[model samples]
Target: MTTALGLVAGVLTTASWLPQLRRSWRTRSTDDLAWSYLVMLSAGVGLWLTYGVAVADVAVVAANAVTLAALGALIALKGVGRGREEAAR
Candidate 1:
């Protein structure tokens, strides 16, 4: 039951990033997303993943892994968008 709860929590929290990712992907712009925000989120999520691994929490590990991937993609998109903007200038 606790594991179930954890999974539910994980899913909810992780899903929060999907909308932003989808929007960013569709628009190919993440100018609204601050670099500091992305860096902090990635760092915090990485730590959660590490903790999950250390504690052998499958739900946490799974959720954080997915989140990290999303964050990585977001960061990449942000960089690409920045480059595009710079090239335009």
Candidate 2:
């Protein structure tokens, strides 16, 4: 079914980032992460979320929504860490 396929695709795409998320959380380090790439990915995910809503795609919406939240948290943490480092200098 198309819905199942979409769900699988969404899952695969979203889950692909979990390892990095876990690593970042565990190490409490975003040092190796690229800020530009993360910002771009967040924006891309936002668009995907919008597309999902537009097309009434439940799988896309759910997957992108969760990914956005997770990435957003990571971005916030990175920003705060960067700010602290900059302040310390």
Candidate 3:
């Protein structure tokens, strides 16, 4: 079952972000993350989500949706922390 395989792969890939998300939340800092990279990644993930929806692929939709949420949280944390970071300098 390719669908099962895809779901497995999706889970793995989606789970990979947990560490980073945990770290970011714990530290409340995204200093090591670049704005450009985040934007690009979000864009790509968004596209994947759109494609998944368009084609009705549950695996892609589920994976990208979760990934996008994580990315959104990361971006928000990064933006909020930026002010403090700059003020510190």
Model 1, 1-89: lDDT tens digits are 98778778888989998998999999997988999999998999999999999999888899999999999999999999999989999
Q: Which ranges in model 2 have alpha carbons more than 4 Å from their true place?
A: 1-3
Q: Which stretches of candidate 1 lie over 4 Å from their true place?
A: none
- Model 3: weakest 10-residue lDDT segment is 2-11
Total clashing pairs in model 3: 0
Candidate 2 residue-wise lDDT, 1-89, digit = tens: 98778778889888877887788878788988899989999999999999999999888799999899889988987988889899999
Model 3 Cα lDDT, one tens digit per residue, 27-86? 997989999999999999999999999999888899999999999999999998998878
Tell me each candidate's TM-score.
0.91, 0.84, 0.89
Give the TM-score ranking, best first.
1, 3, 2
lDDT measured at residue 75 in model 2 versus the true structure, 0 to 100 = 96
Q: How close is candidate 2 to the true structure, as a TM-score?
A: 0.84
When summed lDDT is taken over every stretch of 10 residues in candidate 2, the lowest stretch is 16-25
Candidate 3 — which residues are off by over 4 angstroms?
none
Model 2: clashing residue pairs? none
> Number of the top candidate by TM-score?
1
